[model samples]
Target: MADTFAAALDDFTRRDWQTLAPDAVDDPVRVAVVGLGWFAREWALPGIDRSAYTEAAVVCGVDPEVTAAVAAERDLVGVAPDELRSGAVAEEYDAVYVATPNATHLEYVEAAAEQGKAVLCEKPVEATLDRAERLVSACDDAGVPLMVGYRMQTDPAVRRLKESVADGALGDVVHVHATMSQTMLGELGTDHDQWRLDPDLSGGCALMDIGVYPLNTTRFVLEADPVAVFGTTRSEHAAFAGVDEHASYRLTFADGVEAMCSVSQTAQHASRLEVTGTEGRAVLDPAFYEREDREFALERGGSRVGVEFEQVHQPAEEFAYFGHQLLAEEPFYPDGEHALGDARALDAVYESAETGSVVRLDG
Candidate 1:
């Protein structure tokens, strides 16, 4: 069994996986970041810098001048948006990180796949399930590896939490509660036209943005898919326009497991994930974020035990893991299929919220 599993990994790496670019394994993975927005600048760039196995070699954005300035500042080649749209920029790097607006994920992903470059796209894959499926199919058809940027999947503490639950340490997971909230809109000096506020561009508001963290984390911990979802969403602030400012949803899984999630754009910063089982409960506060340290706690027998992990950088770990999969020819976790599942779930959440009814998922 061990040898067979190893052989499967080898086959996945050699035959099923395409290198980020030709001869990519022989050198540092060269990445062209397709969006220079806040996430790319603050999180992705810093993480790439910290990764010993990857480098940010190029940048592309909607504004050529800003893109050039950012590229120059980072000492990278700046590809024009048109060049990228035309798929001409794919040859310049080993991988492409699509950090563009949610609506634009399909265009960039298709472009990267056509060029046979490995793709690391920011979360949600696409705002809608159909588009997300198309993105996954594009990569599969092109024979290139496609990874979604779910940083928490690479966090050691998060991994340990999932493992503990799976190993029966928590004793038959029965329930999970997760919350991820942030204050983005109605904040001082915020850009309302940044595409995040527009449903046409963002797909949805708070749920599509921060809600996916709780939703995805619940799935990750349980290692199961929800059979049905009921959701409620609200736009409390006028700034939300056509999108939601807050969303709360419940997921009913097989075997009687359930998950409740809340996400908001109007609330103060808060994030947490808690899992309850027959034996004990585990909680991870501030569940999703890239930081140097994280805390996790366990409750059992009228007592609580907690631990803090140090030197944890989720983005850096994510890039390193991707490199490891590419070099070792192994299947990478949190790949496009994983993202597609999350997308479908989120779509159900929105549908349930809109119709004020439970959305039953098809197997």
Candidate 2:
């Protein structure tokens, strides 16, 4: 069997030539960035700022417009605009970033694993539990490192906040309220009928699209998973055939911490989350998309007092933060693993929507 990508670490570290050539470092992992659509052009590209990389590699994509544009703009050696869905991973590569729609996540991951390429897929992993599980099985069998792009988990402030909360700085976990919504009803009216809105592709409603963030964030902050979940999805425009454009949910954790979370594409609202505990509370307002800042609140006797401050790093900085973990073996990487956990939780949420009742995460 071929060695996993991470398996070369010890050998690279123990090389005797390192003493002679002090500048010698581990081999830089090369990756192919698939899906140059809206997300790749805007969000993921900015996060993976081209100038940060010192080595030479190619950027593979599907769209002609995107591949040419990306190649002209960035420092890529080779730009192969090929569809991953049509067997693009036939060539050898170290890693593949599956930036396509949520439905196609599992498909490309399977191909990457078959190619013995490590995968860094986008959020939710897949549209459904079965597909996600298939991806997990494929990667596990191949011994390839599988990571999901819940990039917020890589943020320094977010990680610290999660740790602080986990340490019981807020006494015992109590309640969580989170919201992420936007008014895309105008532009997306004709285009929104695609994979994202289709239940077959999207798997469900807004809860799956963006609401999963608060669900993941809530689980992380509260240090618990839902033992039971109840959710209702609704939409005014009703673009989705059966799924709701807006969804609100109530989750009861095993520790008795209750959370109410909502997501929507029907209205515009700041993506934010607030967590309260016995000792104190914290609020991650503007928490979705590109988070600007976060606020912390401590229980002041009978009243609650809070402080608001800007986040220390830029939006794209999270990519470098994640890169460093894979590059230099940084200790205490909370994001990548937590992203996996969040993906699992998202699967549970979809299951809840399917059954229309409180669904246990394990069940």
Question: What tens-digit string does per-residue lDDT give for candidate 1 at 1-363?
Answer: 232122212221121233344344457788889988877888888888777668888899988888989988988889887787687756678888899999899999998888888999998889788899999999999999998988877776677777668766677888899998877855423667678888888999889988888888788878888899999999977779799889999999988898999988878877889999888788888787664256787776666766634646678778877765766667877899889888988999999998999998866
Cα RMSD (Å) per model? 6.1, 8.8
Candidate 1: worst-modelled 10 consecutive residues by lDDT: 4-13
Q: In model 1, where do residues sit more than 4 Å from their true spots?
A: 1-26, 186-189
Candidate 2 per-residue C-alpha lDDT over 1-363 given as tens digits, one digit per residue, 9 for 90 to 100:
012112211232132211222234355445677777666656666656531422224456655666776767776643554444445544534667777777777777887787787677877777777777777788878877776666666554455556657766666767888898876546344466567777776777687778777877677656666777777777677476666788888888877889988888777656877778776666666676653465444452455544344454432544444444455544323333555555566665656666887767656
Candidate 2 Cα errors over 4 Å, as ranges? 1-28, 50-56, 75-93, 185-190, 295-299, 302-315, 329-351
Model 1: lDDT equals 0.80
lDDT accuracy of residue 342 in candidate 2: 57
Q: Work out the TM-score per prediction.
A: 0.90, 0.79
Clashes of 2: 0
